[model samples]
Target: MNNEILPHEEVINDTLNHFSGKFENIFHQDNYDHYRSAIHDTLDLVGTFLHRNDKPFSGIEAKTMKKMVQHIDLNQKLSSYEEVLKEVDEIYVQHATAFHLPQYVAHLNCPIVIPALAGEILVSAINSSQDTYDQSAGGTFMERKLIDWTAERLGYTTESDGVFTAGGSQSNLMGLVMMRDVFSQKNLNHNIKQDGLPPEASRFRIFISDKAHFSNSKNASIMGLGEKSIVKVPTDNEFRMDITMLQKYMKREILLGNIPIGIIATAGTTDFGNVDPLEDIANIAAQHNIWMHVDAAYGCALLLSAKYRHLLNGIEKADSVTIDYHKSFFQPISSSAFIVKNKRELRILKHHADYLNPAEMDEEEIPAQINKSIIQSTRRFDALKLWFTLRMMGQEQLAEYTDRIIDLTKDVAEMITENQEFELLTHTDLSVLVFRYLRSDIEDLNALNLHVKMKLFYSGEILVASTKVDGQFYLKFTFLNPITTTEDVHQILNTIKKHGEDFGTTN
Candidate 1:
């Protein structure tokens, strides 16, 4: 039977009959118990896996994974739901990266809060689309309220408005799109939205810090501005954008007859976690009448922080801002927003459809969210997670959690600086630390540190990330878990040092 292959039509008919009852059952009060039981069973399986070990990763290899996947054939039917569930546990849960584990300090991933997780379940079960008012109902109002709440928290004026986005990259794209449309219409007297871009579009440029995220360049390309339109401004020794250099570059571009469209100041860079001087940069932008957009995707959580909120003093002055709750607010992935100081400017993205949001409406009719968002239709209820979290835990609680992670980062930085074998590259700007393992016996220090990272990853005990600075490799620790302790970081450093020492001896 294992070797005998059935015909496609026969298999399809058999498959349809196998789970006919499951699909036919409606999700009503009569079947509520059945739904509850299924949910518990699924969650119990995942909960068991998460608590099974303290290791931050699974040591599954590619060849073994290939063999495991080969057995799950669509032509065959499982005997019971339990069998299919068991297969899912083996194939997915057994090999997933455990970001909640304390030893996993690779990227900006955070340990999610409980309220947010609960919100995720409710959001999925209800399946709300925030695209139009009639489709979303109260979900539309809830999302807008949260956006206004965030804008007020950032100290923006009452005229501010925003939309929830997929993440930081999407938010960045929206910000740049608005900047492009506004600049082209005001300066070149050309409407890029209707006439497309003129030939002078190639000469239109935006400035960004050298350490900024790659999203800026990708956004440029997406907006028809071309990647060459990005002007990379130099950074200071601390990795913050040098304001003086930015001024000089702006003056030089003006002399060359180049159009300066915008300046992107990063609050919390990806590698060094450095915050650019917002006040100084804002003044320069105001003088040149250029748009100022702040990419605070990783650092916007500071708004909740009482002690560290001063780090982003001039953010309110920005023409547009990007914020990602997933990075620092301890929410799950794809929770973010793009906000602007002038609510009227969002009209550029408006598209009235007869089937959805018609152009003409009765006096009593309310507008749909599709008019304001770059995403025209069918958006997720991602804002509910943040809303539920804020209501359940309160603002102070979230702020405390953010502060705890920041404090742990400082402790990790101090430990690295004190260790003779570890070389600390930059000081703690937020919750990121970049350093490398070095010893006199090592020939190429960069290669040794990179090998250390790989060895630890495959060992399945812990997981860390590496970055390149000035063409040299360095190990990085991005501490986003509030419960992660100094001891955990100490152990990770020890593991890295041991791996480095062993590799040096073998060579």
Candidate 2:
């Protein structure tokens, strides 16, 4: 100390203390009480909203947001935390839904369980970065094991690999990247990363079911293979992809000399929850030498339940797949995975950085998991929630939870079938059921259904979504809450019926 030289340990200790002090309020242990209470209250609210059990909105809150919110510019820092948080509190007061409420039944979004919430707290506190072994240490191994657990659920025998991502969109993007990797011949012969793809391999094409998530087509365009390059195959009456149409299109496209690079098939379509005929599509992909990627973000939850697992036959045959634990598994906002059968094919992401470890001539064994992930550095350890869900609940328990929603949705569908006021758009094979409010008095029934949906959302006693199916408007009931029941569905129906009967908008 007398020498007036700063010691390295002293500096590190001081720096750590400084950061702990500066970020004290940002993430505090004391906030857990407040945070946990918030989660509980919000979950209750969501439960009410989804099953159409909440009080109708009177536009008071919307007016509040409009009047109170100061236009926020991304570059500007908050003038005061309290000032901003007040607005936020109001926003939540208005927008937050009781998704866990037994009556909540609109969106595919699930009411998250407490165990997963606890995992979220633990993971966020640890802040483990999964970019490298050194970054996450044991967390990397934990995430990989979680991936293995999910792959097992899908019936993958031996060789399977995957990486957890932020959400389904990111997972879908990763799938496209993988297809690009293998098709482009990025690393088979030499260091293709060091040099770009050969000119001949640069041009690419992708295919997706017409009913597939827009993310599939958007991802294709974002990957430099323009949107027009993605061919949309037709689907038959059941809403599953028509294999014959796919074959016809592929043959014609091939005849014109367009290479079939990838095929993206959806397991559960967003509007109808229809599972595509995977076996037929799988056979066609194999025949055409195309990469098969299944976007099973919504229906992937069915794999755990034997009753619903048959809906996704030939899933194991998919070269790549995207699954969203958030959608049906009741995980928090972000938790998705993109997986492939061939472990070695993950080499596409491998590239040596100047700061990265150089391969030692003597070192024989290295784990492929390090370089397999689509993101290069700074990956979040999102697997903890899934791991907790699977290990704690077990697959059977999870399956039973999913089955509960399926049963409730079917009940709601049957009710719709019985009521003249409600017209069934299609029978639900999974959780989501599409229908419309069709009172016999209405001449233009489709327009009335659309009006019912808009009025329902504005009224807010229930929040139901709508979709255009086969050139007509249909209101959607995406039942994902396990605790929901027939009583809940009837409550929503009653609300809709009351609205349908009302002739005046002056409520």
Candidate 3:
């Protein structure tokens, strides 16, 4: 055969050469220097941004930001990394909410530690998928070790097992799924994994505190159990689930022919940060033969606390539990886990695939995380963040941070209570303070508090969260940053007072 280099062939060869140059951007041995340079440049840019950010927010109006974002042309590729970074700085970094700032007491976001940041870099570059042992190798074992450590801290026995998830919502969903399936199998003699929800599924009820995270209701809906499946037990004056009301509700549900399948005890509520009586709740669950799942997404940090670990005294009795490292352990976003006391319960979510985790592999004793995870097949190696955090900071230092935030929250609560201008709704069991600016002269307190929150956001001096209680609006401060002091909180409260006064005079 004769080979001739035609014009079209030459064009194809040139195009291939051009594409080969792009391969240098890939994170491989051939482009190690390029990868290192890119990472260093990005880190430097981030460091500069963090160092210069003085406020939690930029005070840029939504319309202005939307317009700026619209101006970007994604179709046109940037010529250099510097140009791309400049665009990113202008559109995102400059306007991004600085969660690391002491003034940012708005939400559950925590200021992450340096060790976790380093782990994040390795996670992204290595890009290990924690679905199977073959895919992640040592990463799979590391994740298992972290899970085992967390389980031990939670006071679980050797039978306990868990897998890391994206966030609290996902972890909570896993708990609910386990509860639903286990109850169905035991009670109705039906396998939810093989055959869908049983005929008695509608009658299956899950009890939760009225102040519990909304994810429980959402998860119920996703499971084909309507929102009605969740029965909200009234909370006591301290915003904790009242055992009396819970028992009353359980009895009422049974009388009405509803099967109480599960009870979700909130270890730390979103608004008040108060933990339910876990020991009491666990007792109730045992009496009713209901699966007990502890939603400890916010309060799991107490497991490591030297001073406040006793607060979660009965968590060991929970059948399942949710933990969010991102919120309380100071890890970055999307690091959480759903742990089960009995490793056998995970089989409810197990599935076999010929190309992936076949049934025979189980007999061969191969470890595959996907066997326990229902929502995600290919998962990131997020467990590394917690591993690095524990390895570098150690449990004692991390526990100190938790203790510091809890103490800071108490100080802020006292400060709010002392001020006549604000009403401290309830004391917290964790680090969230729920209160509102008050004025006897102002007839509409809700409207006034709403105005203060909006004004603060627009001013960009401080950031705080707002939530409504019993039709009345209230301001919230979620103290997650250990570095945030009482003085910072005092200043934020004063800013709220100033805004409330400004609104009072004008309107």
Candidate 4:
């Protein structure tokens, strides 16, 4: 080759050296000080943002935000940490929705506990993959302990076992998976894991309340069953699953030569926060030899509540249960679990990977969390968040927060009922209120309510949600923050009233 190095070769060498130097930021022991400094700076920024944020939203329009984001050039050279942080603050933190605010009574989102946030820091820094014991070591056992604790709270026996999931949707999917496989194996002698769904899968049906989460229909579709596989039982006046209607549906479906595979009961429905008749549904499921799954994603907080725990009375009878710690438990996003009454049910999801978790490892008594999981391979250490919350705050304190929210909902419902301009739809069993602004002079009530919601969102003073009930639009308030007082509700209602009046006067 040439005695002198070529220009392109020199350029390549320079680039290689630069890339190698970047390894200093790879979070090794040698970069501990650098890591600590960066984390401290980031935390300080976040703390300041939280303290300064006054509104739930910045009221920035979608087109405006999109244009702001589009102006940034991702292909540009790397900038200093300070420059990057400044841009992030302007684009994200400034306009971010403040779920922690008392005015942000819109969705199922909750203001997370401090301990869980601390746990999240450790989880991201350590980056323990909860797939196999060798990958996570002590984290594996720690997660299992939390699962056991949750199972106990759910009144599940020692034989019960579960795995952490992303959220309610994934947890609900796992429950349906178990229901599908167990029914297939027992009735059709088909191993869904090995041979795929049986021919009779089309005939299989799941029963859910009309007000149940949309995940039931989605999960059925995901499992090779059509959307028609889900039969929505009508709800009563209180928006709870009517037990008689459910029984009638089951009999009718069977009469039509369709097999009732499972019942997915909602504990704390999304809009009304009303729980289905769990005990009655459990009895029906047992009588029919069908699986019973409780999607307690929202109301699982009742597991710890001393006063409202009875609302989840027959949850113990469920073959599987889904719990979202992120919702009522006040944990961060993507913290949820799917538990089964029998540990043996998890065997259906087991598989062997020679380089990862081989079959021989099981014989050697190695604990691998992948054995119980279906969709996930490399999973986050989300269980630690719940573990920290329980250890630092204790279950009693958490339950008190739950009780406060439930009590608060009742107070707000009464307030809405007293307001002549407002119409209360249903008295919730949990912390959700559904109501609508009413005006006899307004010919289009739906259009008026919709306009009010949009105006409030654009005004940025308050953040509330809206949903359609029986083809009529209604405003929804989901109280997850214990700090949100009756005064906050009063202010929120006044804002809505003001908007409604503005619409009436303008239109």
Candidate 5:
């Protein structure tokens, strides 16, 4: 050693050797008494540091990260395990999203309940994939049963099946792919999954609401149906899709000899939380004999709410529906389900390679789940969180959680309405409110509101998301945390008012 400059491999090897060993070979406490104090202090310090928020609202911005990591490696020869743990923890864990905090009411999916988090740990430990029975035996069985349970909730027949996906975007993509497989009958007759896209892929057109999620257009583009192929149906004042307009457009397109592929009805839109009149839309879909899909990612959790379940009326008639556990069901992110009214729609994505999910003539149980699913393989058993949450809290508790956030949204709407400086975006349909900061005689404050949002984000006191509606910037609060109270809304309003006054005076 040249007076002690350590190589990279030597250091890494030393660290690994200290951390792992054979269980029986490592249990000699008397031999390791010298290292005992280090472990206790390290564990205690880690737990203690977790309680501290590196920045306000418990979210770590870049500035906060740089401030936390002020020192550079000029050359400290040897550091204790506790010191190294502290440094690594500060760098890595400090910049995490603060879902546990009461103020985190920003995006579609934020916090998850503790039960689901516990399930996350358990599922991670087991690490099951949803590809086959042997790959995730218990997970596979549970997911199938979960599908049946979800089907029952949706009022579908016993033949219905669903799978948990990464998120709403993937679920919607899968739905569109299924429709692609279905409408191309010549390809279906010849078996497309084994074959490929039919030659007539260019003619297929997807009809979606004007207020559909961006993911719809994205999915269309991904599935080889160009974004231009999605015909936008005008929405009514309530933001619900105009079924009459949709029918009119379909008729015009049909007369023009356009191939109608599938109809997508949004159950909950991003802007105003508007759900299309599914009952009316369903009738139009049935009359036209088009495949109907419902993107109910944010609003499908209404199924759990006794009072609000009526909002999703006729959802059962949909050919497929996308439900996000991460958004409304209060599970962690990457929890969503694409449920098909008919189980046969799932067969479109099945692929069989030799070592993967090979098919045999005499094989019982159909030989493969790969055939009846959209995803390729190696799915993180994410549905276990839903299953665990359901079993632990039950539907009633979940409903209560949803109801609490809804009540909070109501409080925010009321506060925004009474405030002279603030304008209410829309009435609270679900647990989301879109509002803007404007005094009397507001013309166009889109750019101003955009700046205000950026300023607020940089300040890191209160958290809210900015959305553009009708070409105007509006601040939105999507309350997912049950613990978020009326007081929290009051805090956000106070901040907005203060910012408005300061901004006006400065301007």
Candidate 6:
């Protein structure tokens, strides 16, 4: 087969030029054939490369990788679209993490479904900005509908409202920002948004579980609350937050004249996947008139799992909540939202911009999404991915997939516990297990575990994550991929043992 372009390529180029420039034709359907051909060819190459290299990941040395990247110059131009696609295939496609692979039991990444994949293509093609109604049209309504649906599932009040955000981190920032402003207004008659934080801002505090995601402290810092403002409540043996300890800390802070502004209850912590006791935490926050926020980024999948929904029993009581569909709902990254129990609370983040959402539009009886969200002036249409997935496959099917992964986690934990060389750190709370290898005659087990993890990572045969627990390194298995089977688990276990034994023998 000839590799050159068609003999009629010049005619096609002339016709394309007659319409407009390349950028202008992209938005018009008249040039869809040209666009479709390029997309089809690119995706075909990606699929073929992935099929050939089924391993989850591979690592290249820093020096070698840097040299390879330096070889590509921005000023250099490729001859044809085929050459561009081939270059991309070699540089990125072969090395990108294959979350679909069963051996890739690493982070909270999920294997995306077909419907969402299709939605992703449509989203990129249309390039809708969901920040305002005029910019996104139906996309604005679609996002709000998904948020309302999610609120209903969590059993929140009918007055609840939410906005799609980049991820859990930004959502957490929004929740805390609201808490800070609202607390200032209610207690000190201060508007932080207008007059800025009070001199006593340093005295304001937010209570959170010891196992909560690091975003709490980071958001506190970003909001000018300072890192010292975060008070981590102790966790029980199961890693769930201790309700009594939280109450004690809150009371002590109050006695010291520090106003407790918010309480963050984590539903599925990053490393352990353990959930805080939401009911108890909610009651404590109510007693103190504090804003209650639940970080359910990892555990939100339980809301869809009919059999496991009770795991997040008191999540609805939260004044605000953060849920990452990307993490738990098996959607692609950048799919998440921050929800509030009362729609009026969203006013704290609202601003009127004449160029975007003007006051005149509100006076003329118009609605725009920019009035709600705290971030993103030009946001991508991500809600379409979830909407299409739910409409095509149904929530029930997704729930079934979630339950399967949870069950797989439990089985894998048992296998690790039964092994003599392996030490299971904590019980399966959601779908994460942090464990390390501990051979009877081995010394410096931490170093051994680290070496084993890096060895497997460099080998590119399988991929998994590692974390530190109580100052010791342990491997982590986050079973978000439903395709990861018992056999895959056994193979990974065998690989870990082999690596550990070899390291011990060599070192």
Predict model 6's lDDT versus the native.
0.87
Model 4 gets an lDDT of 0.91
Candidate 4 weakest lDDT stretch, 10 residues? 15-24
Q: Give the per-residue lDDT digits (tens) of candidate 6, residues 380-424.
A: 899999999999999999999989989999999999989888999
Which lDDT tens digits does candidate 2 get at residues 1-507? 488867999987886686565654445564555456655665665454555434434334567666555564557766554555555656555566656655456777788877787788778877877766667777878988888887887778669988887788878888887776676673245334556544544345677778888887787767667787788999888787888898888887778777777788898888889888889888888887778999899999888887878988899999888999999888998888888777667767765553443454111333334466666467677788877877788778878999998888888888999998788878767888888776666677676776666676666667787888768877788888887789878988988777777634533
| Cα lDDT for residue 242, candidate 6 | 93
Task: State every prediction's TM-score relative to the real structure.
Answer: 0.93, 0.85, 0.95, 0.95, 0.84, 0.94
Order the candidate numbers by TM-score, best to worst. 3, 4, 6, 1, 2, 5
lDDT of 1 by residue, 1-507 (tens): 398888999897886665455753455555667678778888888787778867977878879988999877979888765887798889888888888999999988988898999999888878888888777888988998998999998899789989999999999999899888888878888887788988889899899999999999998998888898999999999999999999988888889998899999999999999899999999988998888999999999899999899999999999999999999888988799999999888878887788887879541377588777885488889999999899999999989988998899888888888888889999967988999998897789878987888888888898888899999999999988878888888888888878887985665
Any idea how many clashes model 3 has?
A: 0
In model 1, the worst 10-residue window by lDDT is 18-27
Per-residue CA lDDT of candidate 5, range 1-507, in tens? 468967999987776666554332243443355355665676676466558753334445778678777765748644566567667766875555566566666777656777898788767656777777677777877877887887888889987988888888888998888777777753346455666666666667788888898888888887667887788999876777887898888888878777787899987787777688889888887876778999999988788889788888999999999988888888887888889998866666666666767756333553444555565577888889988999999999998887887777787788789986888867757877788888554355775677667667767666678787777788888787887788877877787767765654555
* Model 5 spans > 4 angstroms off: 1-50, 54-85, 186-191, 361-368, 441-444, 504-507
Better model by TM-score: candidate 2 vs candidate 6: 6
lDDT of each: 0.87, 0.75, 0.91, 0.91, 0.76, 0.87
Question: Relative to the unseen true structure, what is the C-alpha lDDT of residue 14 in candidate 2, on a scale of 0 to 100?
Answer: 81
For candidate 5, the lDDT comes to 0.76
Give the TM-score comparing model 3 with the true structure, all chains together: 0.95
Better of 2 and 5 by lDDT: 5
lDDT of 4 by residue, 1-507 (tens): 768766998887886576458865787766777788888888887997899888889899999999989999999955566777788898998899999999998999999999999999999999999999988989999999999999999999899999999989998999899999999998888999999888898899999999999988888888889899999999999999999999899999999999999999999999989999999999999999999999999999999998999999999999999999999899999899999999998898898999888876753377999888889999999999999999999999999999999999999999999989999988989999999998878888899999998888987878989899879999999999999899999998998888888885775
The superposed Cα distance between candidate 4 and the true structure at residue 174, in angstroms, equals 0.7
